[model samples]
Target chain A: MNRPKEIFMMTFPLILLLGVLSCLYLESCSAKKEIQLIDSEPYPIEIPKGFPDIKIPEGNELTKARVALGKKLFFDPILSVDSSLSCGSCHLQKNAFTDLRTTSIGVEGRVGPRNTPSLVNVAFNPYFFFEGGSPSLEAQSLGPIETFHEMDFNAALLTKRLAADEHYQKMAQEAYGMEMKLFVIVSALASFERTLISANSPYDRAINGDSSAMTPAQWRGKELFFSDHTNCASCHPAPLFTNFSIENIGLEKEYQDKGRYRVTLKNEDIGKFKTPGLRNIGLTAPYMHDGSLESLDMVIEHFNVGGLGHKNQHPLIRPLDLSDHQKKDLIAFLHALTDQDVLLKPEWAP
Target chain B: MKTIKVILMALIGLTMLTLQGCDNSGCTDPDSLNFDPEATEDNGKCDFPNLTVNFSYSVDGQELTKGTTYTINGTAISFSDVQFYVFNPRVAKDGVMEATGETHFISFDNRSIEFEDLTAGHKHMLMFGLGVDSTTNATIQPSDSDLADGAALGPQNPSMHWGWDNGYIFLKMDGMVDTDGDNVPNAGMEFHIGKNINFNTIALEIHTDALEDEVEVTVDVDFAKAFTGIDLSKDYITHTGDFPALANTVINNMKTAFAKK
Candidate 1:
């Protein structure tokens, strides 16, 4: 009994010293760990070669938690009033983020006016919508959400719905350091959309030193595309494949949709629409603002006929006198722009 | 040790009691709307008397009723809907102007509106905007300061906002007119005036006193003045951007139609 007491007396001091040292080390480590858990980490994006830097709006940086939350919201149907349609419902990854419809059908089967534009590489777009009404991607999301025939939902109500979910509440604190708000919803979606960069096409590969990436017909058609006879490069220049010009391409004699005139209230802006990038054109047809042209041949023929001679037609939209063989080559070149990787990328899918 | 523990508990209880005694701050003005009877100290956020405003529509000095036939520019017309937005309301008393930075949706369905924070004195000038201002019209999303769920500047059922252009339709007058020479008013006539450039302000000279409790003010809006230079037979429909000439004439007429009663 005396021997055991002596052993306990000697071991007690050592144990007490170890206990003091452990408390100091653990307190410091726990402080650092807590900060790491609460704060969002940076999400790195691979900017395409030869493209201008993505201009992320100030106060909203790309973070891993924010992008994940945005992706979840993009696929959620709770944004709609009826909870039946989501942003992903109209923008499918299989069709390069386009719905493959003449015009998208919204909540309650309401047919919208404008064709759904492809969201592939939308980060590079200077402005949003075919009419170019919204200047930033963050503001552009509000258009569809509040439209009467689209989602038909209110932003004020969206906040309440998101706040009620514990997962969303926790994620909101992690991503934005606050509860789910209207600012959080818009900014988070914009961050995820900015990550949708598509520059791995065969044409991109060929230009980036892969000699055998493109076919002979695609090469020949590329030369004609940049030539003065086609004049396609004037409006659709390289890198982004668009110069971001809002112009009247003379698609109609009397337009029902006034296009940018609705925003500017100017007579000259009637029938004018923003020129979209041609990165995934093959996957995103029927073409034009109204999705009137059904096929690539129809689009080529429309340009060949000089666009039905509307008064507001672009001065450079005169007929492209190309042979049938050349038309086939142009179609082949457009197909070469299709990036197969973007369609099947698991990271982009739900 | 037990005696010392009792002293600490008593000291903590005393501190809590002292903190509770310091919370005597609240609205103390008897004339204010949110006057707290139990409050001993006054906070600056005391609401005052409210001045209520209601509109009356007239055509040719006659009361205009919905679905009632009226003649304007030799065309028989009947209005089915008449609605507008009133924003940035201000009342001036003795050269000291106070503005309620609020927007309200007014219609034949709901015609009464109230402006609080008025002093108990006669107001000489009453001014309010006919449409949304440039900054508010830029986007459909209302500012955080605005009543998020209130009818003022919030999303409506029929939707006062134009989602395509991301602006609000300030004034909407929809009805039917006898355009095909038929006696019955069957042809649709829609006049939607909006856009930031078309935002107009109407200032009226009113002789009304806001009592310590509340006061009522009536403002007349003549429907005939809206058709002063407009011919409903040929120029019937305008969504502001599609037919700017007719819209410009109607807005000009609307500006002169308001009078305090």
Candidate 2:
């Protein structure tokens, strides 16, 4: 019995020592093995040669943490004053970042005056807003945030709310190295938005010398678009599909909206409005600044009629006289602007 | 032994926390981040050219003297607030036409010179008459602060932009015109002229040679001559009501003013 006790005392310490060592080893191994919360593959952003480099603001550089936070904020109703709406409320990913409604509903269900434009490739735009009023993406993000009908939240309050949350505070600091400010919040969102480039489309492939990219109908449509019969390329030009210039396409004799003229206050500029890019236009419906047209066919019909019979209408907006096949073909060509890669980005979703 | 064990556990925990914190530091994932190789280089400053335009006018048979106060057909007129715009000026080297620069609103409330030398030649153009071309107008956004505030034009100067409607007032001629029955001091007449559409932009290409050596281009605008095409007495008893009607009537006659004289 004495011998048994001695053996127990000796073996117990040895076993205890082994157990402790194993536990420490396992803990060290666990510490070394990090849980990779983000995917290894980078988001694709192809900048063509000779194009001006896009300037992403420092402190809010594009990162997984920042993008992930922005994505959550975009989908979260917390950004809205009433917790009733989100950016994604109007800019649904499936609908090419545009709402299906003629006009978007804002906080408290107030309808907006203008239609929601697409977010795809918005980073490439040199100017923002319907009339090209906002000069940069950072400046543009502030519009809907404080608009009475949109988020309806003061930017200062937004910054405060973000800073108050421990989770957001940590993420913001990690991404921006400090607590969130209004500029940093918007910059983060803008940084996330800048990554929303759409390059891989059927039209892009065709332009890049891929013969099999476009269908025969789309090919015919492409020809018609560039042809003088349609003359669509005059305004909706190639590459970016927008010259970033405004025009008064004769919507009315005297526009109550005044389009761009509201900004310039020049007489000749009365009815002018910015010419939107045609890329992925098929996905963004209810066309025009007011979302007057419902479909691509209706838009074609409107253009065929040489726009509204207003005197201020653009002289370039002559009658197209496109046939049914031509219209269909034109629509097919527009569909070629859809970038599947942009639409299906898993990180873009909530 | 127990004290030593506690110290060792504390050290392990500290090391783990330190490693965890360090892992996230400088851990910019290349796949998630987009780095522009072009962005490495700095974009140079925006260089705008210098635009200069000079204006002179003749009254009756003689060249109007600089700083001479005179009345054109009984309108007390001074070239005090004269401004200029080039509808689109072409840069000789770029091969691309320069956009309409900011309006150089002249600030001369008191001083007078018949010949006005408008500086910033690369910025201003001598557009014919009062209105900008429709093509240029169509692209201009009213919301553009550069255009709306008249950054080129001096602030608070009365220009023909209709605050009610969305177009520009086509003609703006502000000077004292002798009227039959008007009580307002200065008896100023404003010819705010604009058209929604069907209005033609009279193209007047003032040659570079005309502007060379900063020579003054004479533009003789007779306030009474604006009414030569229309009898205002028959159109309206007074210039008190409905300026648009008056503007419409005056613009119809003003078309003759740009007949390649």
Candidate 3:
């Protein structure tokens, strides 16, 4: 009887000790998980071969948390004053991030003046927007938000709103290592945009010595594009396919929008617009600064007619007189620039 | 103890949330490259794309100040006040010209003008007008501006604008004319010159000092030449009434007034 009672007393204390140890371990695990959230690792960007050297801006290094936060901000309609439209509303990933509307509708369904250009490979561009008003991706980031016809939300209100959200706070703090700031918000968006690089296309492959990749029709179109007669390559060159220059293509005899002239305030620059990259031209249709043209055929026809003459019209943009067959071939060549990496990549897709 | 840790973490997060709010500060001028939108306080630190140029009035190589006596078109006059309006200044560089959209005021007190937010690093020719040009006066209404843009320079309080229909008085030269060349009391000649047709764009016959960030140059205004050929006997004032002779006299003489040095 004495031996059994002593055993029971000793076992009771051991049982209690086991229970306390398990509880402490569980608590420690939970606490460690919280700390891990704060020390989240930076994201990695694997630059494709033969692409332009990417320069990540100072103090805005890429991180998984930053990219994830940016993607969320991009898709969130809370940016708009009415919560009806997000940046992604017009910039759909499948259609090369264009709304296809003649002019994209903004907050309260207000129609914008210019066409939404595809943002693929925009990291290589030094200037942004159709008029090239904004200098960097960071500078261009704030324009749409305050533009009366676009997002139409005040910056102060946006900062306040983002700060109040618990999820945004964690992500922003994790990514930027600070609370919600305008710089962090815009920088995050631009960092994600920097990741939106499109280099994998049939045209890119052809340029990389895979001659059999492009069809014969595409080859003919390529020749015409580079030839002095067309001289399309002078502005839209190979690789990135943009000279990063603004020019007047003689869209109309008299311009209403005034294009780059408004930014530069030079009369000679009137009706001039930044030459958009031709990386994914086929996917991003309804072209030009105003989205006035409905199809690639119409755009080619405009160039073929040499564009109604204007004082500031580019010297090389005279009549092409390309045949219907040549025009079709040119379009096939344009279609050859479909970037599968930008389209089907899980990281880029919505 | 675990519950206490969770509670403490939550409190820390809440404190951080309270700490970070909108604290924006930057240039407020919309025309500047560094325009900040979220700035709540004016901060009075607005920066503009500006080039500095100083205007100095002189007659026959002799600089004149307010209450100074000088000879003009054979009439010796003592200028009590010499104030003028400088219309939008156009800067020409490398054969290309660009204009600042805003107007400016020039007076005895304010001889220095900063051409806000202009192109830098080129040999530039700065051209300005004596008064508001007819085209601008007719198209851009002064009352239409919100005043926050610093538009309509020196309006209302300084007596630049005469009336809504009459438009702004581009140049106001008030003084007493002495026919006998005596520095004594005489008839007052208020040359309030302004009209759409009377607008004169003065091309300063001087070049900037390879204008970079900011360059200071003297804009010489010849008071004598400002009335080269006007019949003082008929009318010495050109205010609201259509005194073409007086207007023409001032416009013709005002040609040689400005020179950048």
Q: Highest DockQ: give the candidate number.
A: 1
Candidate 1, lDDT over the whole model? 0.83
Model 2 bad stretches (over 4 Å) = A1-44, A48-52, A57-61, B1-261
Q: Judged by lDDT relative to the true structure, which candidate is superior, 1 or 3?
A: 1
- Model 1 residue pairs with clashes: none
Our model 2 lands, by Cα RMSD against the true structure, at 23.3
Report how far residue B68 has shifted in candidate 2, in Å: 56
lDDT of 3 at A192: 83
What lDDT tens digits, residue by residue, belong to model 3 across residues A1-350?
A: 69999999989999999999999999999875574454456677767676677667767777888889888888888887888888899898988878788888899889988899898888888777877755557546656765557887755567678989988988877887676766667778887888888778888788889998899999988888888888889999877888979999989998887787655446888899999999888888799999998899998998999998998999988999899988998888988888877777788765
Error of 1 at B84 (Å): 4.4
Interface RMSD of each: 3.3, 11.5, 16.4
| TM-score of each prediction | 0.75, 0.51, 0.54
Candidate 1 lDDT by residue in tens digits, A124-218? 88888988877678777867887757898977687778889988877777887766776778878888898889999999999999968999999
Model 1 chain B, poorest ten-residue lDDT window?
B139-148
Per-candidate Cα RMSD to the true structure, in Å, reads 10.3, 23.3, 22.6
Tell me the interface RMSD of model 1, in angstroms. Answer: 3.3
- Candidate 1 off by > 4 Å: A1-39, B1-84, B92-98, B101-121, B139-160, B172-192, B210-214, B220-239, B242-253
Question: Lowest lDDT 10-mer window, candidate 2 chain A?
Answer: A34-43
Q: DockQ for each of the predicted structures, in order?
A: 0.20, 0.02, 0.02
